[model samples]
Structures are given as structure tokens and as C-alpha cells.
Target: MTLNRPDVFGSISLMFWSIVIVVCIKYLGFITRADNDGEGGILALAHLTRSSLREGSRRYALVMILGVIGASLFYGDSLLTPSISVLSAVEGIEVAIPSLSHVVLELGVLIIVGLFVVQRHGTEKVGKSFGPIMIVWFVTLAAMGLTHIAEDPSILAALSPHYGMLFIAEHPFIAFVASGAIVLVITGTEALYADMGHLGRPAIATAWFGLVFPALTLNYLGQGAMILNHPETVSNPFFKMAPDWGQIPLVLLSTMATVIASQAVISGVYSVSRQAERLGYLPRLTVRQTSAHTGGQIYVPAVNWLVFAGVLALMLTFGESSRLATAYGVAVTATFILTTVLFCVYASSALGWKPWQVLLAGGLFGVIELAFFAANVTKVFHGGWLPILVALLLSTVMLTWQRGVVLVTARRTKLEGPLTEYLSSDAVVNVKRIPGSAVFLHPSKQTVPLALRENVHFNQVLHNNVVIVTTRSLNVPHVDDSERVTIDHLASEYDRITHVQLDYGFSDHQDVPAGLKVAAERHGVELDIENATYFISRITLRISDRPGMARWRKGIVRGLAQNAARPSDYFHLPIDRTVLMGAEVNF
Candidate 1:
């Protein structure tokens, strides 16, 4: 009798079509094409769309804000994913032993803690088994679904689009509420897009259409069929699908599947955080390369522990997978809406699509995503407010960081002066010529490094081989080795002063020592990179009554900078060979 409710069929229809149209067609088919030089993510997509536009234009700024919002919401979703996925899987134990339900939260918390603890060590070994485990899980899902469908062949009627349409027409309010729950079906779709760089579009598309889609559809339909036959199992239809003896094994397998999925999401968060840092949205974080061969395998301790803490808070507060599910869709659906918006912008600007074509596709996807977003908004008081709150907080921090950096750069530029002028000035030309090379890391080649300036003023000496290394993050994902470094002997007036500009993409690892080594090998730049003295400006900020950012926001920026990873650690520079020149920046 419970299965007779319109919401049951309505939710199933919404979910099925969502996967078909939203995930399969919209994201996989169209949005994946908007990847930034084979990289796909909100930030990368935003960069691609706004690449042709002038950097300081209003449109560029607007698109970047959308990327920041989408990225922030993604971070929110990342926080909740581990808690919900693990809790939902572990909660399956309650079907076999209802009394054990009381320990679900505790067990889930312990499992999540273990997951974060293991992040310090790389996932290379654990990653090898992920494919096989996922294969087994999907095969199990398909097998279970096929068995149930055979028992109730009539449940297949729900596949007809009219069942969903009729249900929505008959019970509009129920369909609206159900839409929020329906969205849980496509939870990992964004992460799939985010990881497109690593797996590539072809591989992801093959796996999704070939294996994942069919299995998920069968599982959902089978769950609906089971609910129809045994109405009392509505409380936990998925776990209830298994027979008494199979429940424990199913629970164990489901837990492993969820853990693997959560691991993917955790890795995506680290990638996003790294990209954010490189793009100047966040401060430099400590990034460790887990695998020497694979540059993409990295671990961020700050993100790992922070997300773990958030997951624990959510689990302790919600105490049930159902409640956590209510909070989940808000961030994810909002991100979907933002992604759709970015795609439309990309289609119009970069692809040179006709106005009508862009509008037609954008309008169709916009309606679907907006409906889901609105539906999820109703659950704000229920539990959805958590992610919204998190997104807002993170967005504020990101925007503030960007703004503060701009203000500080403007001030610091005046102090350091032009690099060309500084190099040719009497202060540098008359200095004592040191024996070895001194590599100074600066953000721009046009500006002098504060460290170099201070060293010249205090020590009154310049290295015979002065390499001004400036690392710039390009809009693309990976810069080619040939185009990676440019060696410029400034104005030919100073042969000893060489300006080396290093270009990197968002996904590329920033290793100053390695980049310099490549410069020596590839560009034939004469230098002792191994024993080079690296000079980094360690700026201690002091707040002033400046015309730039608000004092409070400036303070926030200062705090973030203070806690950021040291330059030596971030650039993988040799610590013993690096010297920190302290400079005071007032803004």
C-alpha cells in the first residue's frame, strides 16, 4: 500500500530520467566538451569560457565568481560525502541485526577517521584493487536487480515516462519533495567530470555508458520492484532486497564500495584545492606527491583533516543516513546549476555556437537543474542549511583572499620597483659579484623580488649568475616541456642577470628545483641549480588605514598567509640552501 503513493513512482522516474538526461546527455555529451585543454572542473571550465575575454572585464569577473561559488559548493559536498556514503552502507547492518543500528554512527565515525588517517600514505596500493572491487559491486548490483525484476515483471511499467509525468501531475507537492531525494542518485556525476583530466573523456564515457548506467538503472528499478512486493521494507528497501543470509555480505561489500567512491571524492577535493592555490583563490597548502611516477597522486593534509572533521560533525549531528541525504542535495544541485551556467557561457563564447543553439540547450538544462535546486531549497531547515552555510563561508574566504592579494601586490610593486630598472640601477650594477648563482623566486618578471632588493641593500652583493625565476600558472591544464621555460637575458646590458619565466598549468606540479633543472638541461641556461642559493621573500603583513580592503578582511588574509605552507616546502626547494628575507608589507 505504501508503494501506491505517487512519490514512489515519481521519485524513481525523476531519478531515472535525471541520469539519462542530466548525467548521460547534458554532462557526458555536452559539458565534457567544455574541458580546458583536456581538463574538466568548474574552475577549469570557467577559465576556458573566459579565456578569450579581457582579464579585468566585468564578464570575466562574473564567470570567475560563478566558478568560485561552484567550487565552494563542491567543497561543501565533499565534506558530507564520506559521512553519508559510509553511514548509508554501514546502516545496512541494521536490516540483518536491527539492534546494531544504535552503533551505526560510532562505526561510521571510526571508519571515516581511519580513512583520513590513511590519506597521509599514498593510495597507490589501495587504488590497484579499486577497479576489481567496483567491478564486483556493479556485477552484484546487476545480478540482484535481475533476480528481483524476474519476480515482479509488472514493476517494469515504471520505466515508461508517463508514469513519472502522471505522478507529477497527480501529486505536484509530493513530486517536489521527492525531487530532493531523487537527486541523490546522481551524487558522483560532478566528481566524474572533475576527474576527467585523469581518466580522459573517452574512458569515462565508455565506463559510464557501458557499465555504470545500466547497472544503476537496474538496481533502482529492482529496489522499486522489491518495495512494491513487500511494502513493509520501505524503511530500507536496498538492504531489504537481500535474503537473510546475504545481508551481512551485502553490507560489507556496500561499505567497501562507498569507501572507494568516497576516496575518489576526497582526491578530487585535493585536486580542486591545489588548483585553487595555483589560481590564487587560496593560500599555498602543503602538497605531498604520493607517487613518484604519477605526478597527479598528491595528498593535502589540511583538506584531509578539515574534511574529516566536517564529516564527523555532520554524522554526529544528523545521526542517520536519511537526514544526511537531506543536506546532500543542496550543495550538489547548486553546483549542477552553476556548471550548467558555465557550460552555456562556454558554448556561446568559445564554441562560436549560434545564439539560438546555445539558448535552446541552455534553457532545457536550466529548467531541470533549477527545479532540482528549488526542490532542495525546501529542505534547508531539515538539514540542507549546513552545506549552504559552508559554501558561503568558503566563498567569502576565497573572494577575500583574491582581493587582499591584489591590494598587497599593488603596494609591494611600488616597494620593489620595475625589475628592468632595478637590474640596471647603480645599486645592482655596482654590487660585488658573488661566485655562485642566486635564484630569486618572484610572481612577476616585470617586478623586482623583495628578497633580491633586500639582499642588494643589506649585503651589497649580487650573484654573478642571477636567475630571476617567475612561475606563472597558465589557463590550460599542462604546459608542454618545450614551452615550459623561457630564458631571457634582460636587455643584453646585464649578461649575468637572466630572467627565467616558467609556465605551468593548473594540474601541473610546481617543483622549482625540478623546473630549474629542466631549464639547465633544455634551455642551456648556465647555472648550478643543485647548489643555487634560493631567496624567498617572507612578508609579515601589518594592517594600516589603507584605501583597499576592509581591516577585518585584511586581517583574515593575513591570518591565511601566516598559516600557509612555507615557500621552501611548497616549491619543493632545498630547505638548507634557501634563505628567507623578511619584509614588512603594510596595506
Candidate 2:
């Protein structure tokens, strides 16, 4: 009854079966309404839905909400998983050598710190070796569990639906609480999808079903056997399954596996943050390119440091994995439910399903997920607040960044206008004597920006030819240089204004000046980057005593904004060409 890969008669047959199993598992992981097992999990899904919405599609709102919830849960899960996985492994040290119990927590903290420190070096160099190491880890777990299963075949009974269900039904309250702990077993499954694009669906599926899943199942069953035989050891059953001689090695191996799991979650946060920036939910940050070829391979220093600090704080506060479990399950469960809702919307819009059909399927899944969410919610008083607080803090930053962009865009739209107005004005009478044409590059769709009024009044002399360039995004993946720019004459003297819009794909970087140059030449205008002055309105946030968001969340948003890198750097505009107009506003 051990959940091992079925034996094939020959190599050809084995290959055939492997493909079949991997393909099936891949689809299961993809369509199960769960987050992508690879780097594209709930957060990636949220970005997709948000981008779709921004493109004038309102149908995906519900789906986006669900995705947000699911991603938020994952954040919570991130906080908890490291604690549990690392702590559980450390506890093994205590079981192996009882005298080491006093130092177990300290050792676990040190290990967690070391793991965080190495993250600056991209995972790619070390990750290539992860698969092979994990294979060994899985095999060891399976082999160890198999030894116990041989002694009592009945250990397989734990796999039955009845056991889990009955355990819940009889001790409803404790089971509800314990479910938070039990869910940790499958906590990393979603990582399979989040990291899907990196490992590829086929490889992850092969790794999971072929090795990880069976090993995990066997280990759980073996642990169950130990609990049944020596009920006294139920407090920590996993370690009890190991023999006296093998305990130390098992502890070492388990710690390694947990470290790998933590690494995956940390990396996932980095990937999601980058995606968020592209989709406009996050502010422009310093993104260090990790790999020349892989666009997705990036390092955000702030995020890395933040997560490291949080993980350290978690290790210090919780001190044990069990307490951290309460916080972990709630966030992950919430994320799962959110993803289901988003998937339903995607199925209807993208897949062209009928509304009722989407609702029916979504509703069914939602009920099951909500139940799990509710079960986790009951643990709020225990220690669930930690992950929620983290997610709330993150969500505030995301929302604030989004709001700031919108406000800036709105203010720009109000200030700029067609070049013809300046040409007709008597104030530009002196411009005829000026040497060269003045080009103002404003980041907006409107010909005039609100903040430009003061600049216009101060610089009364208008250029013989004025160009107001603005960039626009298209739904298509890319716009050729020839099609990137467009020009329209405004109704003012010899003054003329041009709007330049650049259509960049989500996968592409935004290069404003380069795009502007290409666009101007394509539209029959002479390219002059040197003559162009980039007018960027820098919004200085004022925190009013008037109530807005919760005090803590508002503080988080301000901190995030304060740390946000300037947009000029993000768009690769030269500092010499930039003009900073500062204005304070309340959110």
C-alpha cells in the first residue's frame, strides 16, 4: 500500500508511464484552483487578473479578489512554514540526544539566519543541485517509513478518509486546532506551482509524484504507527519512528529539507514582488539583474532584508514550531480560498464558460476552502495574528503604491495640454528671440499636466516648437519602433506639441527616453534627447491627523513609499534631463 511509482516491465514502458503520470499531475496542479506550484502562485495570478482589469475589463474583479486573498494567505504561510519546518527538524535533535534539548532552539535560529544570509547569491547556482538532494531526502524518508510499515501493514489505514474524518468528528475542537498543524505537511505543495515556470511543470510533477509525495505519505504513516504503538510518544510522533542509531542523521537530513522549503518561500516573495511592480501595484524599486538571459531572475535588496528580519523575529518570538503553526495555516488557507474565486472568474472570461457554470464550480470549491479558512480562523487568539499582520502590512504597501501612481497620473493629466495654446499666448512673445525650441517630457496622456502651471508661469518664454511627449501601454505584447510614437499639432505660434506613447509588454522593461527617441523619429520629428527636459512631479505624502487607513498600516505604507526608488532611475532617465516638482498631498 506504500505510495511508490508503479514498476514497469521495461525502460520504454517506464518512460511512457512517467510521461503519462507527469502530464496528469501537471494538469492537476494547474487546474486545481491552487496557486502555481512554481514561482507563479497566487501573487502571480493576482497580477494577471489586475493587468486584465486595468486594460478595461471589469469581469475579472471577483477573480482578482480571490487571487489577492490566496496570495495573502501564502504570505502568512511563509511566516509560519519556516518556523514549523525548521523547528520540527530541530526538535529531532532533542529526540536523538536528549541532552541537546536546551540548545535546539538556538541551533535552529542559527540555521535560519545562515539560510537568509546566503540568499544574496542567486538560487540558480545552488538550485540546480536542489533536485538531486531532494531526491535523496525523499528516498530516505520513504525507506525509513517502509521499514515500519512492513512490521504493521495496518499503518496504511491512516490514509483512509474515515480516519481523518472520524478524528475530526469526534474531537471537533482539538481536530480543528490540530488541522492547523496537519496542513503543514502539504504546505509546500503550492510552491510546486509558484516555481512551475522555473522547474517546468513536467519536472516538478515528476519530482513530486515520483519521489516527494510517496516519501511524505510513507513518513506520515510510519509516524502514525509509532503513535498507535506507543501512545505516550504522541506528543512528537515523527521522531519516535526513528531508531536510536539513526536519530541524529534523520535530524540532520530533516533540517536540510526544511531549509530548502524556506528557501523556496523566500525566493517566491522576491519573484512576486517584481511581478507586482510591472503590473503597477508596487512602486519602482532597485531591481538587480541576477541572470542576463532570464528576465525573471532578479534580486530586490529591500525585500530580501525585510524577509530575513521577519524570519529572525519569528524564530525569536515563537521559540517552537507548534506555536507558529497557528499563524501559518490561516494565511495559506485564506490564500487558497482567494485563488479559487479568481480561477472561477478566469474560467468564465478566458475559457468562455457560462456565468452559472462558473458560479456553480466556484461555489462548490469556495465552500470547501472556506471551511478550512474558518478552521484556521479559530486559531486567531492562539498565534494567528502574526501572519495576518504581515500580510496586512504588505497589502497596505501595495495599495498605497497603486494609489500614488493613480494620483500622479491624474495630476499630470490636469496640467499638460496641446502646444497650440502656448503659441497663441502673448506671454510667448519673447520666445521668438530665444535660441532653441524647448521640449517638456511629461509622463501623462493629457497634453497639459496640473503641476506644469507654475513652471509655465515662471518660464513665460515659449519655444518656437514645443513637444509634450507621453507614453501609452497597448494590450499587444510589443510595438515596433516605427509604430511606437505618434504626433498631433495643437491649436498655439510656431509652437507644436506631440504625444508619444510606448507600448511595452509585461515581460519588457520600460525605457522612456529610448522609446521617446524611437517614437519621434518614426513620427517624422527630429530626435533630440539633449534638448528634452523631463518634468517629473514628485508627490510628497502628508500624513493628516484625519483618519484614513489604520495607523499601523498607514505607517507601513509611508515607510514603503519613503524607501521606494525614484521613478527617474526606474525608467532609466538621465538625472541631468530630469526636473523634480514636489507637492504634498494626503491619501
Candidate 3:
């Protein structure tokens, strides 16, 4: 957008240095090292820090608030990335044929809908081609940039940090404003750490250092060189890098690259949403495994369609990339800031980094990201409010759900009472015992299953054999089978009533029936897998004069709980053999 040669050089320098400092140094060198059991991401980083920080400390509270804010902003990034990416790539049509500009939005929407539609089929087949396609895209980017740089070698001066400083010193306000747009260069940098669970750090670092980094550097330099040589091409310098005959092919390739990028972001939303659900920050939703061979290759239909609706609305409302760009930087830069803060916490608390090291590293990235965030803040009235609004809404939902769960769990624990006491109580001693086995799924093994209590109280009968299954979701990515199931005979007097704890990682599949079968086989727990009637507690939450949370927040939690997926479906239990016992609980 800057037509002046000096402005172009300064902007190029700003972007180049951002890549070096924010991405190459901070993320690749520092942030990626702070993994939660080989997993990386904002939430993973939070998980790592939460382990070291005292639970009720102020710092712990800060990390948690930042983590939720970071995660919420991620949804904003997920929504905007696809909209802006597809729109920007499709806008290339305007450069190739100006008369076709009108169809850009139509084409973009079509491509977006098609991309989301195919998500149900899983990315296994199409994902095989992503690496090759991206490699070609990067090569093309480098080649095109090399040609332009050769034409105007003066643009290479942008490699020095002085130009960026010079730009800021000369035009303070303009530089601050330009920082907002410049942040886009490092937009997808978070994914490097976020996807470490799926693709390890070594592979990601190698890919970055070997191919992605060099390609991006050359491409940015080439765009600057081309803009310098032909100032009139400033409006669409990327497409202008190609020859007239190659323009169409370049456009086609750009569209595919954006589609691949969008796919990654969409999948990330699903992964983080699942993580949130497991961590008790969100209600359970139906998760479908699209690839039987690959555990991470799963899809959430509700998230897929909800995001599509948002992306469609953004494309229709914004109408072009430039306008959408205003909304994009706020969420991304905010997330960058959150990640930096969390990393500093992890470094100091977990990694045992000295104060100076932590401060120096954190302050550098914090200032840089904060500047970008402040710059984007100026565009709030224009379109920046969209992401901030999205982040606020999602954060509220997460926090409310978490608070509601705590209150309800506490109340339910009192009502259910201790399992040991209940098993030895006079009521249980006089209860008529049935012949068949009954399995009850509860969140805690220490407490009596609510459904079990209800069944004995109202029906006046108890199963001869009872199994209490508690699925515990740990913060790690995967748990070994050796530690998966722990069998505890609650009482030798009532050996028929056994307690089984099934441990799972956040990424692990939550299949209760399958876990029960494994427990029966591996741990010698007694249970009829096919014939046992699985009992689930369907707790009905009602608002009361509770001292926990605000009335409005409680209502939101109730709505979310009401809309959550059925426990049987989520736990992969057989519907025909499952029974739900309803009970009222006030919060």
C-alpha cells in the first residue's frame, strides 16, 4: 500500500525483522521447547505451567485467565484465517482479469463451503498432497522473488534492522499503523508450536529451517523489489511477480495453498475444542473419528458447520481481503502476546530459568507483540471489533462452564456421599440384590454413582455385581496401556462392587465400553461387557440462591449443559444396553 520507495523499504524491513525476532527466535527457539508431554499449543503451554504453579496462587490465576483468553482468541483466528485466506487467494482473479472482480466473493464462498463439506470425509486422502503442494508453492514463491530481486538489488537493504528503525523514527504514527498489517507475515507462526503433538518439534523445525523460512524470506524480498521497480504494481505486487502467461497458474496454486492453510486452522479448532471439553472448560460434544488409523484425524460436525457460518458471514460482510485484514490482526497479535506471557511463566516456574533470562526473553517478544496489538486496536471501529467480540463471547462460555461444573460437582458429591460409607450403610445391607451386573459411569470413583444411589433408593433393588467406571482425562497427549486401567476392590465385604479407574490423555479416545472390556480382560475385573446395563446420571441443573456465580452466567452454563451430547453417545456406549437415571441438582 505504501507507494514511496522509502516507505516500501521501511515496511519490508519491519516485516523481515518481525519474522526473525518473533517467529524464528522466539517461537522456534524458545516457545516450541515448552511442551506438555510432546504436545505444544497455547493450552498445552498452560497445562505445563499449571503443573508447576501453586493451584490457588495469584500467578496461577493469571496463567489460567490468560490461557482461556488465548484459547478463546484462537477460535477467532480459526474463523478469520479461512475467510481472509480464501478471499485473498480468490482476489487474484481481479489481477488476472479485472472484469471478473465481481465474482471473487462468489468463488471464495464456493471454495470455502466445498472445503468444509469435505471435512466429514477426513483429510487423510487430501492431506497426502498438502506437503508436496506447499513445497511447490514455496519454490514458486522463491523463484518469482529471486527474479524481482535481481531486477532491483537495492531492495536487499531491507535485510538490515536499520531500515525498520529508520522507518519508525521518520514516520512514527504511520509505522505504528503499518505494524498492524506487517504482523500478518507471522500470522501462522503459532501453528508451528500448536501442531507439535501431531508433527514433532524436530520435523517442524527442520521443515522451517530447510524450506519454509528461506522461501518466505525470498518471496517477501522479491515483492519489495518488484514494488520498488514498478511502483504502480503496489496494489497487487504478489500476482505481479509472475509473467502474464503464468498469472493464471499462480492464482490456481495460491488458492490451493490457502485452502491447505485453512484446513490446518479448522482442524486446530477441533483439536483445541476437544482439549477444552476434556479439561472441563466446555461441555462434551460429539467427536467423530474420521480416520481409524490416525487418532488425531477426527472431525466435530458442530464446530465445522458453526465455523463455516461465521466464515460465510465474514466474507459476505467484509467483501474483500483488505477489510478482513483489519479484523485479523487483533486476534492473532493478542494470541501472540498470551503465548509469550505463558512461555515466560513456563520458563521461570517449570524450566527453572533465571530471572534475567526470563525477563529479557519475555520482554523482547512482549513488547513486539504488544506494539502490534496496540496498532490493531486503532482499527476497532473499522472491523477489529469482530475478533475481540468473538474472543469475549467464547471466553465467557468457557469460564462459565468451568465455574458451573465446580459448583455442580461439589453439590453432587455431597448428595452421592462416599462410596465406602454407602456400600456399608444399613440401607445397602437390607436392599434386595439382583442377579445381573450393572455398570455406572461417574466422574469420581471416591463417590457413589448418582445413578446407583437413585436406583437403590427409588427401585428398592441393587445389582448383585456393580462396577463404577470413572474416566480420568489427564493433561498429556497419550497414556500407555499399562497405566490405562486401575482396578480397586472398594470393599472386600462387598467384593461384587468394584471401582475401575480408566486413565486417558486429552487426545485419547474416550470409549467407556471399550475401556471396560479392556479392564475386564487385562485387570481381571469382573463384568459382562455385552449384557451389563450401563447406568448414566442425567443431572438436571436448576438455578438457585447460590453464592458461586452470577445468575446470568449460571443460566449460560445450564443452557450449555442442556445442549451437551448424550453421555452414552460420547462414551461410545451401546444405546440398547444403557439406562439414564434423572436427578435434579440446584446450583
TM-score of each prediction? 0.92, 0.76, 0.94
Count clashes in each candidate, considering only residues at least 3 apart in sequence or on different chains: 0, 34, 0
RMSD to truth, every model:
2.9, 6.9, 2.4
Instruction: Please report the TM-score between candidate 2 and the true structure.
Output: 0.76
**Alpha carbon lDDT of each predicted model:** 0.84, 0.62, 0.86
Deviating ranges (above 4 Å) for candidate 1: 5-10, 54-57, 121-125, 290-297, 434-436, 472-485, 491-495, 501-531
User: Of the candidates shown, which would achieve the greatest lDDT relative to the real structure?
Assistant: 3
lDDT of 1 by residue, 21-135 (tens): 8898998989887776566778888878779567798888899899989999999999889989999999987887889988888889888988888888865655776789988
Candidate 3 all-Cα RMSD? 2.4
In candidate 3, how many Å is residue 583 off?
A: 0.7
- How high is the lDDT of residue 374 in model 1? 95
lDDT, candidate 1, equals 0.84
- Model 2 C-alpha lDDT per residue in residues 436-508, reported as the tens digit of each score: 4344545554345433444556664444445566666443435666666666655431345454556664344
Q: Highest TM-score, which number? A: 3
The best-first sequence of candidates by lDDT reads: 3, 1, 2
